[model samples]
Target chain A: MQAWDISFSKLKAGYGSHVVLTDVTAALPAGAVSVILGGSGCGKSTLLRQIIGLSKPLSGEVRVAGRDICTLPPAEFRRVRRRMGVLFQDGALLGALTLAQNVALPLTEHLNLPAEAVRAEAVRILGMVGLSDFADFYPNELSGGMRKRAGLARAIIAQPRILLCDEPTSGLDPITAARMDDLLLSMHRRFPEMTIVSVSHDLASLNRIADYVLVLRDGACVFAGTQDALRASDDPYLVRFLNRDGAGDDAAAGECAAPAVQASLDRWFAS
Target chain B: MPQRNADDISRASPPVKVLRLLGRPALRALNAMGSVTLFMLDGLRHIFTTRRILGRTVRQIYVIGYQSLFVILLIGLFCGMVLGLQGYYTLVRFGSVGMLGSAVSLTMIRELGPVLTAIMLTGRAGSSMTAEIGVMRITDQIDALDVMDINSVAYLVSPRIVAALLSFPMLTAIFDVTGIFGGYLTGVCMLDINEGAYLYRIVSSVTMTDVAGGFLKALVFGLLVTTVCCHQGYKAHLRRDSVGPEAVGSATTSAVVISCVLILAADYVLTSILL
Candidate 1:
């Protein structure tokens, strides 16, 4: 099977007065995973939004499967959305809905399956995510890692050709994150034709899966290269970030990270 | 407590006191009117911004409106029966049971139908929309829609607005019809009047103007119900301040209160002009 690809051309986007992505031009190979890494509020999610058509670029276009998604009508756009799947940063599993219902939402909205078939498909996907026994359970009933897995389950329930994930492993423990990484990799290997694009601060996870890494800082890419190239680069940010033991870096200065990063690396940006 | 200075001792005259007393209702009216205006403007903005989402919206309206009819009609039937029984006893004291038909038809068709129906819809459908949209808004499902290149407003608000526009009127008509029947049963079966007279008075005594008046009032009330509920939902979507429950209560209450006030107000104004 051939690979899927996503490309953005001269894209500009913002929420009202704040321009988040400024003339972003990038490409993600079909059948390959690309990791867009950046600090929180540095417009990484905004760039992801531009690619998915959630956030419109103030200029230029986003092309997926050779069509400019920016120019498609809303219906056509939603039809385009059927070709891709997204796991939200917060999981967004619709807490009130059961795990089965949450996973089956896209199917119910888009497919022609019978009720039993939809239920079976939901169960099958939930089983793949290791939530087979919890089909009747709501999102609030699950743990964080389970919620992320359930989100991934829902994203792939329709068997989309492209996957967009935001912080797939942010809240999980190291072991759980690795488990999720393995799960994603196995899925990637199985659906090798699907393009997987994820925005994450988890450098370790990125190193495991990312074929191409784009480093974002202050709303722009500071580096765009192969993961091996990024790891070998002498840039203090790359070295310090990849080491995982480094005291600080501007990108890792956000919430829930090490306190050492805040004290030492922030001064570098201030200078 | 006893040390009253000139500023503390300042007192208004009886006439001035009466003026303040008279101004309270006006002030309340202004506030309610202001909220309604703001809500309507916001609803119109959402409607226009997502024109292509109308097909789904219309389907939603059809489902909400038709599915809700039985409940609305059930409530309307009881309401009409109670009104008929009460009106009959009240008219009997003056031997004015003949006037009972006019009273029930006029009241039910011109006022209670729209008001009660709007209130009922607010409780059933309006609250659901607010809760659903509120959750979606906070959890960034709306943002998800945006990323999928879909307009959240079109996907969410338009169906609800269309539901209100179509639902309330159908329910109000049911109320009007049931309430008249309730009156008929009381006047003909219980009171032993000519069945023809009871039906004639109901069908004839209610002028084209009265039916028209009911429809006009219902149409506007439908807009108000949709507007208030959708605004509360949208606001609940944008702000995660636990205002959803409070807004739901306020939206339902305000929908009933405003629809009644406007229906009565419009009735008076419209009656004066048309009659």
Candidate 2:
């Protein structure tokens, strides 16, 4: 029933010298759906990774519930992680385990509940996701949309106070994406105090579920505020982003292909 | 004239540049070795701390040891039969065909059994371990485990290590027995050597020390192979040579090659120490 606010202070992160996120300072309020929006390579996932403790930031702090997890000892960090859950871009279900077993993993690992109880809880969550009929199936056997739903079921089944979803509806159809957003809204209502952070570029999903919004561009947080403030802002880039316009962007400044490469393509098409 | 970069300007001479080039790879190799050692130590630590490790270990043994039985037996039998035929002919030339049984049994128990069985297993189970974990790493399942506060090493690698430790010696024993039988079929049934003399030579010449030495080699090979495979898979994402599924493929290949080479290298070092 408890939720934690995530705060970032000048966070810098990347692999080796390839910095993906720089000076990303923001507060994702507790008990709110905070959507992180950016272009394909603007460090949304990197920022999420920092919050999840998957990879430590190069410099600065990521505080969950006022404790800077960036410097937490391994044991302490693990305990912090116990209160959090994540839905990866893909389901990331263990291929060796069935859907029921995958959903039950957290309970089995962290709780001393009987096997039947765990199974029952897993099935109940699967039913919540409308996948009760497919509880015995493997992740690979499910469609992409179904997998995402299953992943959500697994992520929320443990009643984590903080849930992070990475690109939750990136590859789904519009209908499925809408359904996912509704499911997320229902989850928020179910646990009113749970902090949910999602990395997404879906403007529709953002409009549907986001109470708070953080927008990144060129490895920097350009906007962090409520959805209404985000929409009302007159920033040219944000306006263009909201309108789905591509004018004056880098791609618009260049030829689609090199002249030589275009000529080669012309020759191929001539064939 | 070509423009010199800052790095080029900093380098003093051709000889120094060559030394630097050589040193870079040497340093990298050392770094890799250190990483593998630490990874193995971490997995071993988790093996002690993880609850219900026996259940996981048993499952891994079924996969790594039981599933690998037929191939090991087939290879072991042929190796012993070949040794039997070779030893008989060589001893016959020396007018000491009676020593054929000692030759076959000793060669098998001391050297071929553990080494060959490990090499076979490296190809079979070790490669599978690398691929399985590599796929999991790329697909984010490992990250999923981490997010759930599950120790990924304990959940994945430690059980395989424990399984390898128990199964290697057992499989080696099976290899030795099957191989000795194969030798009997060759030396006695096919080559018409006296069965009693062959049996007596094996019983008389083979010592408990030899058997223990063979088992020691097997255990060492098992540890090395499993550690190498697990390390490769665990670090597949960090490899400079590839990415995604290609990285997994590269890791699997490296696991098998590295495990086989380490088996031979460690066999030499262990044989010397045990001797």
lDDT scores in order: 0.75, 0.93
lDDT by residue for model 1 over B1-275, one digit each (tens)? 33443233347677866676667768976975686577676556777675445676776676568777888878887787787789888988998777777888888988788777777776677666666666676677666555444456666766677667777777788888988787777777777766776666677688888888777777777776666665555556333333545644454455445445654665567557655
CAPRI verdict (incorrect, acceptable, medium, high) for model 2: high
lDDT of 2 by residue, B142-235 (tens): 9999898889999999999999999999999999998998999999999999999999999999999999999999999999999999999999
Worst 10 residues of 2 chain B by lDDT: B1-10
Clashes (N, CA, C under 3 Å) per candidate? 6, 0
Q: Give me candidate 1's TM-score against the actual structure.
A: 0.68
Q: Which stretches of candidate 2 lie over 4 Å from their true place?
A: A249-271, B1-10, B13-19
Name the top TM-score candidate: 2
Fnat, one value per model = 0.37, 0.90
lDDT of model 1 at residue B165? 73
